[model samples]
Target: MTQQTSGEMRIEKDSLGEIAVPAGHLWGAQTQRSIECFPIGTARFVWRRPVIRAFGILKKSAAIANGELGQLPADKVAMIVKAAQSVIDGDVDEEFPLVVFQTGSGTQSNMNANEVIANLAIRNAGGKLGSKTPINPNDDVNRGQSSNDTFPTAMHIAIVEEISRDLFPAVTQLRDTFERKGRQFDDVVMVGRTHLQDATPVTLQQVFSGWVAQLDEALAAITATLPALYALAIGGTAVGTGINAHPRFGDVTAAKIAAETGHAFISAPNKFAALSAHDAVANTSGAIRTLAGALMKIANDVRWYACGPRAGFNEITIPENEPGSSIMPGKINPTQCEALTMVAVQVFGNDAAVAFAGSQGNFQLNVFKPVMLHNVLESTMLISDACRAFDTFCAKGIEPNRAKIETNLKNSLMLVTALNPHIGYEKSAKIALLAHKEGSSLKEAALNLGFVTEQEFDAWVIPADMTHPLPE
Candidate 1:
């Protein structure tokens, strides 16, 4: 059932027969049908610019490949390429208004791209949008592709491009910021905690460096999956067979995409696995999940360190971006940490969705293409945005409250562990307990207990030496 609209409507036809589409829009019959059938999540498709653009890239590459193989006329190919370029440049992002929930295989969105591009090419060639005269959506634009192959192909393209072009840079920038902070805080010794209790001493540098290392490992894990994402399943038109597609269509299209995008994309050697299962997307998302876990740890630690000026740890200070409370006039909070940690949680949830959807490959086709890829892309962009925001507003502005750090370090009973080498673990434990019980300094506790003289206490309980190895 088409929604009643007050506008000039054009009649368009597909295999399902005629449907009325708005005259001002570029999409045709199939897209119009999808709009009616799945009247859901109208605002949901707006963020899918990357996926739509990936379709444009795939469509353009297909036309080029078809033209090169003498499968499509040069004039038609030219019009399709120009029209597809408009999609790739985001000029026609508004035309692709199909939500992620429309079709599990993203068939509707594939047709949506086909119709929009086909009509654009038709209009470019001085023909009616729905006539399919100078260009046909199925025959010209989607000449050698199917929703089965092209949908996953576009998923890979979007995933690879978004990770490489957006996520990596944002993560790298934040990692570099933490690394620089590590250097700046290298000399600042601080108390370390395990199980939310003081355990030993570590420089603030070590904490920041640990975050850098986690990011490095996560980045490598994500990078390892890109080669798999670069593998395109284009020639497997419907099932795993080439069928109506040209034999070299996948290879030529992958090569064209690689050349255009500056990524080393190739045709998947096993199109069956490529189209049947989205394990590449799942694997990449797993890596992103690890990064999310790291972000959770980093953000939580930052917030804990910046807990309070008087009551909590108060060892570090983050940026004060805004008023932190509704009623409190002078209170500030770790808002960036909260935002980043929330994004990390969201990525974790998205990972679960991606994993579940990726596992739903029934035989030769995974009908869960849109859900799986949608989650992966959403996680990627979320982490990218979160990392950049956290870096700019919080991590980059982080500064050790040196006086507070020294006070905390001096007050930590865990520093008694440093005296273990000289007096033994049992005696060190006694001294720590006594200091805690009596609210006395380690030196006072040791002297009162006759565990060590002032000179011995001073030598053994040096906080600087406790940060790393030292001889007794």
Candidate 2:
């Protein structure tokens, strides 16, 4: 809703020159320059709520640290902190109008936040908006910090917050659902497929167990990356030298951030590495990529398992929540699984973008902060939402097609593998081949070939036991 026509305009000036800014907008010159300079996409940083909130939190923390250090007066610090709180509460989302494709260093976004917070502080303190008198964007709001460090710090904090607050719980819920299904289907045995061909007898519970394990591993890997991410890149200022930043700034700001976020936020051990490289973020992206792979596998498994009532695997029926087809009658697609799979693909894409962005760090700063943060935050939100959706829409509603499972289990030639321990591999293979050739059950083929007695076949060919074999 930018006034493309004749709305009131205000003049804002930066180091470059004066520009016509929207009259009511809180963002000032740098943000205005970014708006006019790079009209790349309508996509703005407004969608990145976590990043913005983290920026707010970082600003508030910095103000507190600076105030305690006597760098800024207490009144201005209080005003800045309150303004930053407004940002955290999402009271001024419209104030931030910069896009993710702005300067690679995210200086524009940093200024956007500074300007918004400063104007709000001015208004709260009974001063005029756009009057940077007591609450200057640079001297007060952005004191002792630079986009080089603060942006990356915000990126890390936001991602860590999203993962801990949202994504981990969603994934854990999905994992727990899989565990529930595992126990529920413990005795329901079916033919296990490898390379899309029958391989051995496996209980449905065991398949679910494997799924739970995959999710567990993925969640564990993602969680393991948190410690690295908790190390903030703040207080490094323009470069790794700590420039105008106080020596106490890094630790105090980190402590304040940790207090606000409820996460263990630590100052980066090496400011140079934190500012100049984004390997931690890259490691996080890699973890998410691994989780995406797991989700893709699980979603595809569910989709394939619920494929058809008359054609495919058809061993489970997903809940019919909506009419799946326009013309076809009584059609219920595995839409949730399809959605989850698509999300997995999208996360994969986001991770690729994040990985590439993370590597784009040149010398004293990574210029790809905005895109990196956008992609990482997008991946976190998508995966979290997809996990929740898959759990509620698909996992919770899965119905075992016991009749089909039994039918397939009874007819499967791979059941002969269960007889290997008792009858030897060669004889088992022969029995399996005979069953396939004659279109007979392994039991029937074994009986015809006199490979074993009925009593022995019944004793040794228990599918449930095959899922968890007692040590030979």
- TM-score for model 2? 0.96
Candidate 1: residue 247 lDDT (0-100): 95
TM-score of 1: 0.97
Off by over 4 Å in 1: 1-4
Candidate 2 residue lDDT tens string, 1-472: 2423358887777678787877777878787787778878766655568878999999999999999998999998999999999999999887776777888888988998998899888888887767786699999999999999999899888989989989999999999999998899887888889999877778888899899999899989988999999999998988888999989998999999999999999999899989888988889988998999999999999999888879888998888889989999988898888888898898889888888888877888888888888888888888999999889988998878999998887787887878887889999999989888888778888999998999999998887777775775
Clashes of each: 0, 1
- CA displacement after TM-score superposition, residue 79 of candidate 1 (Å): 1.4
Per-candidate alpha-carbon RMSD to the true structure: 1.7, 1.6
Model 1: lDDT of residue 315: 95
Against the true structure, whose TM-score is highest?
Answer: 1
lDDT of 1 at 93: 80
